[model samples]
Target: MRILLVEDDAMIGEAISQALKDACYAVDWVRDGQSALSTVHRQRYDAMLLDLGLPHKDGLEVLRVLRAKKHSMPILIVSARDAVEDRIQGLDSGADDYILKPFEMAELLARIRVTVRRNAGIAAPTLSNGMLSLDPASREVTVDGVATLLSAREFSLLQALLIRPGAILSRVELEDRIYGWNEEVESNAVEFLIHSLRKKLGSSTIKNVRGVGWLVSKGE
Candidate 1:
């Protein structure tokens, strides 16, 4: 998954960016609300972590603008604004969730998972397509009830496919989800990941469209 992190605090931003990357998310971070808006207009993200206090433009204004423009990606407000009204305003202004500063990294991750799942209209914590199951929190994949370990990049690629079973994703789309700005993408990175996943699962686990992309079947 890809995330847009809008934070002004250098220390906090660095910590959050590293944590998200460790969890297999591609993150692009900006220090101010204007930069956030500019980045979103040009790039797509699975979700956004926004701070209310920002320079150039306020985060609330950014949120309203994105929503007004019909950008539906989930938005989670991470702010020091802990007042009751502040929380209410954040949500009312279109934030999917709110987290106060000095919060646990684990909690923040859990909330992001929940918000992303909610936006995808998936109610379960684990993602699955009849024959394969992926646990986001555990980063574990189970093939027909048999647990299988996967490298971080392999898990990332498979997770992107299983998120929307039966839907094919091209290399570009998969790369966008798996790599963040500044990360080097090798020439055959996507192909290599797909090959590794297939070997670990089954030869037919992922299907490739000769001239298109790859997909996991929607059902067994």
Candidate 2:
């Protein structure tokens, strides 16, 4: 999954970015609300981590504009604001969830997984097509009861396809799922990942529809 991270504190932002990347998310980190707005408008993200106190534009203003534009990606507020009213205000302003600073990393990750999964129309924590099961929270892929590992990008690509097994997704669509704004993609990046996944899972696991696109073979 891809996430937009808007935080001004250099240390906190770096930590959050590293953590998210380690968890298999492609993240675009911006320090101010204006940059956040620009990034969101131009790029696709599964969710956002926004801080209320921001340079250039206040975070609440960012939220208002995003909602006004009918943007529906989940937003999670991670701010120093800890008062009851602050939480209420953030939620009322269109944030899907709120986390105060000095929070546990595990809880933060859990909330992000829940928010992104909810946006994907998923009610369950694990996704599977027959014996191939993936656990987003654990970043684990298991086939036939045996555990396997996937690189962060490989995992993101698989998750995108697994979201709608049997639905053909074009190369451009898969690229968007695996990349963030401002990142340069190699011409055959998607194909490389697809090849890697096939080697790990099995050659027949995914199907390519010639000039159309790619898909996971539908489970019977």
Candidate 3:
């Protein structure tokens, strides 16, 4: 899934962006509230990581404006502002969750998953397609009663497909979901990962249409 990361601190922003990418998430980063506002209107993000302090406009104002316009994208406030009032204000302004600064990357990723799943109205952490089972909370995959070890990119690719098992996703769409804005993608990156997953999950686990794209097998 794609995430919008808004932070003005160069060091902090870079760190978060890299961490998100490492976790197999697509990230688009912006440095100011105005830019954040503009991107929200222009781009499709599964969730947003917002900071309270921002330039050209306060992040809180951005939150309020987005909520005012009735946008339902899940927003998580990640700031150094750990005060109770700050947390309350962020939630009141439409943020779905709040994470204090100096936070653990794992926790941030977990919260992002929770926020996105909550938005999707999905309560189960384990997503399944046919005989394949993936536990998002545990980051584990089991197929046909056997466990499978998948790389981060492999898992992300499978999750993207399992989320909508029979839906065909173009290479560009899968790439958009699998890599961050800054990552270098080889020409056959998706094919390579798809090969790995198919090798492990079963050859028929995924199918490719010559020029169309790829998709997980549909259940009978």
- Each prediction's total of clashing residue pairs, residues at least 3 apart in sequence or on different chains, is 0, 0, 0
Give stretches of model 2 more than 4 Å off: 181-184, 218-220
Local error of candidate 2 at residue 161 (angstroms) = 1.0
Best by lDDT: 1
**lDDT (C-alpha) at residue 214 in model 3:** 94
Runs in model 1 with CA error above 4 Å? Answer: none
Q: What is the lDDT of residue 111 in candidate 2?
A: 97
RMSD of each: 0.7, 1.7, 2.3
My TM-score estimates for the predictions, one after another, are 0.98, 0.92, 0.87
List, residue by residue over 1-220, the lDDT tens digit for candidate 3. Answer: 7899999999999999988877767899999999999988887778899998999989899999999999999999999998899999999899999999999998998999888878876677777766788876556789879987677888888878877778899998888777766689899999999999888878988899889999886676
User: Which candidate number has the best TM-score?
Assistant: 1
| Candidates by TM-score, descending order | 1, 2, 3
**Predictions in order: lDDT:** 0.93, 0.89, 0.87
Tell me the lDDT of model 1 at 197.
92
Residue 43 displacement (Å), model 1: 0.9
